[model samples]
Target: MDAVPGRKAPMASGSAPDLMYCQPCAEDGNKILPDAFCPVCKEFLCSTCARVHRNQKITKSHALQDKTSMPSSFCAESEDEKFSVTCQHHSKEFIKYYCPRHDALLCGDCVIENENHRSCMVEKILQVAKRYQEGEEYISLKTGLGQMVRDIENYILYIQVRMKSVDEENLTNINEFRKFRNEINQYLDKRENELLAEIDQTKRTSKTFLNELKTKYTNIKSATEKLQSDLHAHEANSNQLLIVGKRAIKELEDLQTALEKVSMSKDVSRYTFDRDPATERLLASETAIGRLKEGESTTTLGQQQQKQEKKQQEQRKQQESKQQQHKPTQAPSHKVNFQSSVDLSQSQFSRQPDIPMKTSGDTRNCFLSSVACLSGNRILLADYNNQSVKLILRPTWCCPRLLCQVDHGTCVNCPVTGQPSL
Candidate 1:
């Protein structure tokens, strides 16, 4: 029999059948002509078979189309048609109900056998599947999936931008480093050339000194040889021998004096190259030459502090000398003993009672800018209005005698040394 166009015929050589045989009836060795096709089961069905299929609870929901209107592709048997939808646990039963608790579609036998679904509600799988189609849960799932996709896309973009920034930063750093390195190299090259020139100058100077000595020696040797030859010739002529001998002896004495003056002396000609002490130390230790040393900064700070202290001391002495000129009788010198009794371990300081001091013979309003307590009841006070520092001696409680007044500038207190500076 000739095969229908776009449809597969059975694997049998025979005369043409009046109608297409039902696949399910063929399996039972029955050649029943099919009137309809079950799309879900992918089977051709006779009227009687279709009625039986519709009567079954499991297959009732399956869609059936008239065989005459069915597509040629549906009539053809494909690889998908070879598979049957049957329960893995119960091969004879079709999956019908959905167990919500187990989240699985199960046959009636499987639903009964699964102990977890014994007390749980089981709904028709077709009804549950219908609920999933465009339902609230389905819409929410789609929205969530879309949000996740958008979030992932944004994250990817963020990562890309971050990576690009990192790359650019890394490139910038690399360029900056290269530029710095180039500058350093250029500086080093210039310094190297300068040093080389200095070394060359030293070499030329030494060579010149040596060459001068060589020329002097050469002249001396030539003079001595001529003198020796003249002496030998003069010996043969006794008459002129005495005169030539005297001149030769005089020349020899002069040569000896010149040689004594030319004797090697460091004070006359010394050629030694001295490296900077810092550079020498770096080389000796095999350390990087350009790196800053901790001691250098510390020493610089120490020197500045010393200078500051020295300046303060000089100011203090000038003030003291000026105060001494006004006093008729010399004030007895007193040493101030600054001793603290506070325990360091306790981290506590002892507070002393505040004593107010007043001076006598000051009727005018005086704005005191600075005050310092000296030894033996003496206090130095700087009056800003008067622009003068007064050395007042408090002999008795409030009765003060003005010892001296000196022209003053801004006054500073030397707390560490307990000195008054102006």
Candidate 2:
């Protein structure tokens, strides 16, 4: 039954085919199912598109099939299979060739009619792939890939180890700061002792002179009181009193004079403690005792590892060079005949007419430089004197035959593409 309007989206009914979204609608970012398969276009079409495909002159002849029939001859293609590359200019055609000069992938129509490729010598994709399989760039890519994987793995391991190492390094910094604080404490203790001693010396010096004066005055007062007691004792005897009074008066006069002189002496110099301004400034400032210098936050072990690795590399290079210098070449390899499993029983060696190797600009005898072989008994040769490479074709003794010599064009290695010049 057809889906009714205002109902839920269509579902597979009675196994006619499990519902699938329309390919064209999906391309346009819609999700409607109720589709049928078109083998000619190789796309699933919704009912609306199916009706259009049947009536439209361009696609009217295309037959539609059930949406599902997988595990049989016909089936819906996966995304990869449907990943066909079509030209932007020719939307319906697939790309078949690559134009190196234009540096673009093109279809047959693009090669023939596109003015961009008119002067360009286009290459077939298969021919472009000739050296791609075993080329140096491909080998280097594989090597670089493995190296990147190793570097990433080492970095991951480094991170795992660094997590713990970082904490240990932080602890080291903490301990170092505490040690610096201890050093500051020791220094302060030294300064405190010196200051305390300075105060002690000042107080001691001030007290010394005052203590001597007080002792002298105390002795004088004791002597004066004793003399008064003596004078009263002498009064009981008249003659004794008369004789002693004269001497006693004289002693009293002398003691009075000494006391007067004692009060007349100059004041003693006072000693005091004056703290250094630097001490007060030190107390006022937060960082006076300790300055915090921020070190570069880099992993020490990582740097050490880099250095060790560099050293090992240098050592390895030295060892390699030394070994290469001392190593003996294998002379047997030069003596060994070229070995091959190819059977040449049916092959014959025949003499052919010699072709001239001289060029118009040649000033010396034509000397052979190098040779390369191609398929179908063709050989390539380089003539150093003529400064040209020659392609020689011999009779195949089979269906096709060739002329004497064919000089195609000059060839140099394509550094960018790594493609061999034919």
* Top TM-score prediction, candidate number: 1
lDDT tens readout by residue for model 2, 1-422: 22312123434666454445676676567777645777766666778988987997657877787557411223443333533788888998767688888778988788899888888889765445544545676789999999999988888888888889879988988898899889988998998998889878777876887787788788778778878888899999999888888888898898888788877766677666676798889889998757757776655546869988999999999898778745653333212122212223444445545655566777778777665546666766788877778776733331111111123223322223222222
Q: How many angstroms is residue 168 displaced in model 2 relative to the true structure, after the best TM-score fit?
A: 2.7
* lDDT tens digits, residue span 170-288, model 1: 79777877787789789879989998898788788888888888788788789889999999998978879989999999999998787767665333255676768976675688544
* Superposition error at 199 for model 2 (Å): 3.6
What TM-score would candidate 1 get against the native?
Answer: 0.41
Q: List the residue pairs that clash in candidate 2.
A: none
Off by over 4 Å in 2: 1-97, 102-118, 123-139, 159-163, 190-209, 221-249, 260-269, 276-422
> So what's the TM-score on candidate 2?
0.39
Model 1 spans > 4 angstroms off: 1-95, 104-109, 130-136, 163-167, 170-174, 260-422
Clashes of each: 0, 0
